[model samples]
Structure formats: C-alpha cells, structure tokens
Target: MSRESFDLDIRIDPERQRVAKQRAREGRRLMLLELGVAAALVLGFLASGASRRLKAALLGAGLASPWLLVGAYLGLVLVGYALAMAPLGWWSGYVRAHHYGLSTQTLRLWLADEAKSLALSLVFGIAAGEVIYWLLRTYPDTWWIWGSTFLAAASVLLGFVAPVLILPLFNTLTPLDDEELVARIRRLAERTGRRVAGVYTIDLSARTTAANAMFMGLGRTQRIALGDTLYSQYTPDEIETIVAHELGHQVHHDLYQGLALQTALLVGALYLAHLFLRWGVARFGFAGPGDVAALPLVALAVGLFSLVTMPLANAHSRWRERLADRFSLQATGNGAALARAMTRLANQNLSEIDPPRWAVWLLYSHPPLAERIALGSEAPA
Candidate 1:
C-alpha cells in the first residue's frame, strides 16, 4: 500500500511487509527463548546444587586460592552456557536470517564470526568474573558501589577503544574513499560545531544486506562508520541527512549522557545483585557472599533487573533519537530528504512500519517509522 506523508509518498511492499512481520515475531520468540535458557541455566544450577558441587570439585582439585577457584568455576559455567546456546544462536543468527534473505555470508564465514565473538566473550567474561569475585571478597560491605563504578569506567574505556581495537576483529573498516562524500560529511559535522576524526566505511555487506550507519567513540577516538551496504545504495543527500542525525548525537553530547544513564542503571542492578547475594548465602546455603557457588544467584538477579529496567532505558533512548531527528532537520533544513531517507531505510532494512504499542514500549529504541515521517513533515523547511 502507498502511504502518504505531507512531502513524500512511500510504498510498503505487501510481501515484504508480511515477511517483516514474520521476522519480527520470530525475533521476539528467539529473544524470549534466549532469556528462558539463561534463566533456566542459572536456576537449575542453584536448585540442583550443581554450583556447590562444582565449586567443591574445583577446591578438591587443589585450586585452593579463592580467586583461582572462582575463575575456574566461572570458566566452566561460561563454556556450558555457550555450548547449550550455540544451536539456538546458529538458528536465529544464521538460518533464520538467511531464510528471510537478510544474511549474505556463507555458513563458514558465519561460523568464523561466531567463533570470534565467543572467544571475545570468554576472555572478557572470565576476567570480569575474577575482578568481581575479588571485589566481593575485599569490599564485602560495599562491593556493589565499588563494582558498579569500576564497570562504568571500564564501559567508557571500551567505548573509546572499540572503534580502533575491537571492531576491526569482526570486519574491515577503511576511510571512505569518496572524496566528495567525505567532504560533505565533514561539512555536516562542522555545521553542528563538532568534528569527527574520520569518516569510514565498514564491511557490513560481508555479513548482511541491512543498511546502517553509526557515530561511535569518545574524544580523539570519535568517528563515523557507514555500512558499505548503505554507502552503495543511498544518495548523497539521504546519506547527509543520516549523518546529520548522527552528528546530532555528538553535538548534544548524547554519548556522555547515555553513559551517565547507564552508570546509574548499573549501580541499581548491582545493588540488587548485592542484596540477592546476601540473601543467597542463607537461602542457598552458600558459605558467604564471596562464595563462588553463589554466582548463579548474582546472574539471576542482574538478568532480572536488566529485563525489568529495559523499558525505562529504551524510553530514554527513544527520546534522544527524537532529538537527533529534529537536529537532522534543523541542521540540514531538508525534511523531505529525511522523509525520503527514512522511506528507503524502512524498505531496505525490513523495518515494520507500524509495530504494536507494547513492542515500542518494551523494545524500540527509536520512534516508529510513521511517527518519524510525521515529525519530518512537521519540521520547518
């Protein structure tokens, strides 16, 4: 059906719409399934007394140091969860994506990507587990506060380093070769009174057909990445509108604001986890809050807290996205271009034009397409 906005007419392909709805349903189900699996793993470990037995076994194996014991226990649990979840990950990320004509990678390439992701997870997971356990032992009275602060700082550090250190592990990134396009983007950033270090194109086409662009990093590390898929398809004007929205993030200092919000939430979640750890020492027969056996309780507490608070986080994110949209219009003074860009994005990305209200509350980090289009129409020319 052809949908009319004040400045543009956009058509939603009926078949694509049906496919998009189907994909959305499957994606939700997969999310629920992943959550269910995680909850079950943690709960089963606690209820079955498996955590206690595993810790005992590790101690018996002469891992007498608390740090070593905790590290080993966490490593085993991480491997077990990954093994259990691997099949589902493959299905959702590979099989289902391919079925929907979204994925472009061969199975081998997909598996390689998964392997790299798992390796990164295991490395970080084990390290974080070690630090967290150390904090639990050393700062038993206020580990939550200390741990949350450390994690927040670590998150900021990661943001600074990821565009350089971490992202290259997954895909190739090169300075965008188009001189005209680069100049245009740099000019857009200047218009917003900010400057990006560089404009780069990411090899997203190596993995999927979906189009995207992002403004990432902090300080000198700050840069913009346009997916090759988007670069190949979108016109310069449409691309500029997208870049303006990203520059909006920079101009508004949304990155720092978002980190602050995240830090606040992390404190809340860890505080909840700390309480659960104390309660678990009695309820689950753990020796103390520092006992490695009580790790499952921590996981359960943190996961549940995140699930409950996701809506609030998403609501804040949507607000920021709206501000960026308005910024894009104001900076570019071209609402029609934004509207057209959004129309293309909807079709190319298989975005659902009119998702349900509940989904928006729970899941959406940006306003729905119709709302964005209406906002564009109402923007000053």
Candidate 2:
C-alpha cells in the first residue's frame, strides 16, 4: 500500500489509547476493592452471631420438624428480604447514583420506590420457593429437569406481567411526547428491519438517578421503556445509540438466552443442593427434607457454592455485554458517539474507572468501560 493509502486506512490515536489503558487499570482496581468488600460482608454476617441467632430462632419455633420447617423457612426469608431491602436500595441503587449526579429523586421518593420493590420481591420469592419445594416433593428423582422447565416458564410469564403489573406500581408510564424524535427512531428501526413497538417514557427519576432504556415483553405487549432521565439528559443522537443497544439485545436473542442459561444454572445448583442436603441434615441435627431449622445451613452451603462460581458467571455475562456493544455500533453507525455515551454513563454512575483484574473476574457483569470504548472506536475488521 502507498503511504497515503496507509494513512487513510489507519485511525489510531496514541493519546486515546493511553487513556484507555489507564482506565482499564483503574477499573480492575475498583473491581477488586468491591469484591473484597462483598467478601468481608459475607464473612461478617456469618461471624457476627447473626447466623447462630437465626438458627436458634428457627429451632425454637419448631422448625426442626420436617412438617413445620417450610413455614419457618419462609418466615425467615421474608424477614431477611425486608431487612436487606433498605440498605440494598440506598447503597446499590440510590446513594451511588446520587454520588455521580445521575439521580434526581428525593430520598422520600427513593424509599417509596424501594417499598414497591420489596413487595414485588416478597411475592416472587415466596412463589418461586414454594414451586421449588413442590417440585422436590413431587419429582424427587427428576426435580432438576422439571424445575428448569418451571423456572423457564415462570421467567417468561414474569417478563410479560412485570411491565404491566409490577412496574406501574413504582413509576408512571406515559407515551413518548417528542413526535420528531419518535419519527426518527421509527425510521431507524425500519432501516434495521426491527419491529417498531410503542415507545413509552418511565418516570424513573421519581425513584433514582441512574438513566437507562430497555426493551420489555415479547410479541404484542413488547415495548420500549425509556427512562425520563435518559430522554431529558441525552441528546437525540445519544438516545438513539442507547435504543440501538437495547434493540441489539433483542436481535441477538439475549433475553431468551439469558433465561435458558439461568434455568440450567439453577437446575445444577438444585442437584447439588439435594446432594448436600443429605449430608447437611445428618451432621446439622435437623430432620430430613423439609426441616426449616436447617434453612440457614442450606443457605450457607449455597452461598459458598455461588462464591466459587462467581468468576465464571461474571465472565459469561461480560462476554454477552461485549457482543451487545458490537451489535449497537453496527446498528447505529455511531461508534464514536457510543464510546462517548459509555464514558458519560461511567462518570455519571461513579463507576470505578479502574478495577483490579481479580475484581472484574469475580464481580463485573460488563467488561471494563475502557474495553467497551475501545471496541466502540475500532473499525470493523
């Protein structure tokens, strides 16, 4: 190739590359710190007499008997969910978003939002647990297969109902009001051969600061939900890029794939749980099978199992996210814009720009922002 031709083909920038490297390092470091914190919390919960108190309470409540144990277990889980919701919403969803200036909602609104979430969680968790319990009793030898089937069905059913039922409880949904922008997005969807569903705006700022857009449901109820913050904060082009990313997920069948993977994982976990339950009951002084007093012991075993599998699960999710990023770039034809959007999102969310490699391996569902930006900027090869 001639010198001019070579120059035309190359779009490399050393300064951008250097910045990307620094961001990657920082991302890794931050991930490590987060993982350490999570581990410490888990250990503290086990060591601070909380686990023992729970076990004692269950036992004293007649949970040691197989018949009454399920009720006891359910009660414990309800209390745990209630206690955890406030801190989880504040730290994971609210405070971090506010710290990064992404959230616009007041504290009262945020708490109210969390209250709705708690209600939803309680309903779903109890229902799912009861289904599992029933499956174990009815199909002891084939619970894994039946359990997977049930879980998959439940996921699809929930996906359809959530937007219409659970979501409206937390935020008001209104039709998108921008006619011109809606027209442009419709054109983009048409050009990409994607089915254009109704576009709706969610009052997300009423509860939290993080901005997002999503594609929800399947078939007729399938619609696009754009957070109010995304509409107000991002320019039209940026919003288009975000919408394209969500469309990419749909195009790539990510939702179905994710559900299938989760079902398989759950089946495997339950199989192992069955095996462990046998030995656990023998050693832990609990009645077999439905003994509620042993719920804490079962949870402890599952927690340890999940901790060991964390890195593998994180890697799988990161890979899927990277694929979605590529699909967004291809669909939008706005690679640089997507990169800018990603950076803005990271900055706005106070996401650790740099985290340790070990931390990313253990905790992150998305690749480091630096990696995503680089991929966004790179030319197709």
Candidate 3:
C-alpha cells in the first residue's frame, strides 16, 4: 500500500506467487469437491428411505399445506448443504484467504458475514422455491417457459436494486472524498456522455487486501465505486485506468448486452433443468415436478448444467474484458498507467500473471495480466 510504485515481480515475491497459485488450484478443487458432496447428499436422500420418511414426518405434523412443505423442504436442503460443506467452506473461504495474505478480517467477523449471507440466501431461496413449485403445479405443461421467464426478470430486477438494497449489507459505501480524483472521474464521465449517479469508495479493506474499481447498476442506479483498497494503494492515474475500464463497459453498452446474453442463457439453462428434473422424477420415486422433494434433483441438475456451460460463459467474459481493455486504452490514452495498475492489482489480488491455458479457457473472466500489459505497446484503433 505504499505510495511509491513497485515492480510487480518484486512486490509479489516469486515464492508467494507460487503459493498463491497453488492455493488457487486448491480452491478450485475444493469447489468441485463441495459440489460432489452436495450431489452425493441429494442422491442419498433420493435413493434411500430418508426422503420418504422426511416427507411423511411433515405430513404427520399436519403441515399438509404445499407451500409450507416446500419451505420446510428447502430449509432442510440448506441445512444439509451447509453442514456437509462446513469444513470445506472454512478451509476454502477462511483458511486459504488468510494463508494467501488476502484476508484482513478476523474469524468472528468473517463468520458474521457468512451468517448474514446464509440468512439472506435462505429467505430468498425459500420464497423463490415456493414460487417455482407453484408455477410447476399450475402450469405443468409449460412450467419451464414460465420458470425461465420469471428467473430472467428476477435477475434483471436484482441488478436494479443491488447497489442500494443489496450492497450496503456487507460494506459501507461513501462518496469518494478525494476532490481532485473525483474531478478527474467526473471529467471522464462527462466526455464519454456517461452520467454517473455518484462515485463511491467501498470499505473493501475491512475484509481483503485486493484492490478494484467497477461500474454497477443501470439507468438511475448506475454509479462507479472504487475500493478503498485501490485508493490506498494506487496512484490517481492508475485508479483512472481501472475506472476507465469500467466506464468502457458502460459506454460500450456491455451491461445491456451481457444481460441479454444472460437472459438467453437462463432460458436455455432452465429448459435443461426442466428436462433433467423430469428424467430424474421418472428415474426416481419423486411425486411430481412440483413436489418439494425434487428440490435436490433441480439443484443437482442446475449445477451440472451450469458447469457444462461455464467455458462458454468464461470465453464470452474474456472477450468482453479484452474489448473493455482496448476501450480503456483509447479513452484514457494511458497504457503505461494501466500496466502499472494491473500489475499492482494482480499482485495484491494474488492473481496469476498468466495462468495455465486450460484454466484461462475454463475459469478466467478477465485476460491475464501479462496479456493486458501487452496491450500497452499497441496503438488504440
């Protein structure tokens, strides 16, 4: 976080970079392992007497209401998944973060955030589950179409509310205080014809050391936010380089394009989930498409579907990222500043400068740091 610029190689330290890379690999493996554990539990419930007994217990309790049954069913799934993944979650989320020197949070604070997130997920999940089941029951013949439509709309609505309603839950966001830098950002916004609602700095340092800047929301909700981590560590131009890349996203209309792409993909993913769930119901003893017991079937099917489509998602993301980088270069005309900023970000975030090609194709959302830096030598067209 020194004011002076530092060489990326020296600052990151080769040994530490190696450790971070190894941690990255471990983190990915743990993710797959967690999914395996979840699938296993779902399979266990479906394949054993437990699923029927649990359903029977609910019936015996006079909670014969379908809505209540779906709620309770998903609550059980959430509890099971949390318990089963607890150790792996701790290792991957807390242990690995601390080991890599990324986390600045205490265990208690981290747990508090996790608990809040879990509570939010549970509330939203149960409500969404209830709706989906209702739709399936009401319109069994074309529930997939309804489900996809509802989900696509929900995703877009979530984006509109995320800045104000969702983001404040975890981090404090205050208007960026540096007058000079604020002026610079506003100037860029003005020139680009992108009206920003506000420029804010998020309390990113409270949890992690990684620095970042981004544009969020759409229309009235649209704004730019810089992590306090970025403010503390990076130069003004470097910060501009980052923010400009985000602005590029806005100027290029990537948000709307991305949303459209996402909606199309959601429709496809939901249809696939529907098909898989139907296959599952026939293959197993689940009651029907709307049956609460089939929540696991839906989850596992969706998980598999997402994994199968990830490479496509990642490739599209990388393409958008490259375009953004090129846009930033032209907008700011500060390739050197961008290279420096990217280097520092990579080191602080423990990003591999150039990850394995397979990982890039399968997982990376942004181009590698080296690839970005190489853009420094090209003339913006």
Q: What TM-score does structure 2 among the candidates reach?
A: 0.77
Clashes of each: 0, 14, 0
Q: Which stretches of candidate 1 lie above 4 Å from their native place?
A: 1-10
The residue-level lDDT of candidate 1 at 53 comes to: 96
Which residue pairs does candidate 1 place in steric collision? none
Sorted by lDDT, highest first, which candidate order results?
Answer: 1, 3, 2
**What residue runs in model 2 are displaced by over 4 Å at the alpha carbon?**
1-69, 84-102, 138-141
Candidate 3 C-alpha lDDT tens digits along 1-381: 235564443343576578767877887788778878877887787778577678778878887999888788788778777777778888878898888888998999988888888888898888878888899889876887888888778878888998989889998889888878888888887878856557888889899988878778877888889898888888888788888888888787777888888887777777877887779777777778877777667777777778888898888888988988988887788887887787777777887777889888888888888798778545443
Q: Rank the candidates by TM-score, best first.
A: 1, 3, 2
Highest lDDT scorer: 1
TM-score of each: 0.95, 0.77, 0.93
lDDT of 1 by residue, 325-378 (tens): 999998888887888787777787888877889999999999998788777767
Better of 1 and 3 by TM-score: 1
Candidate 1 lDDT score at position 166:
92
Better of 2 and 3 by lDDT: 3
Candidate 1 positional error at 333, Å: 1.2
Model 2 lDDT at residue 53: 66
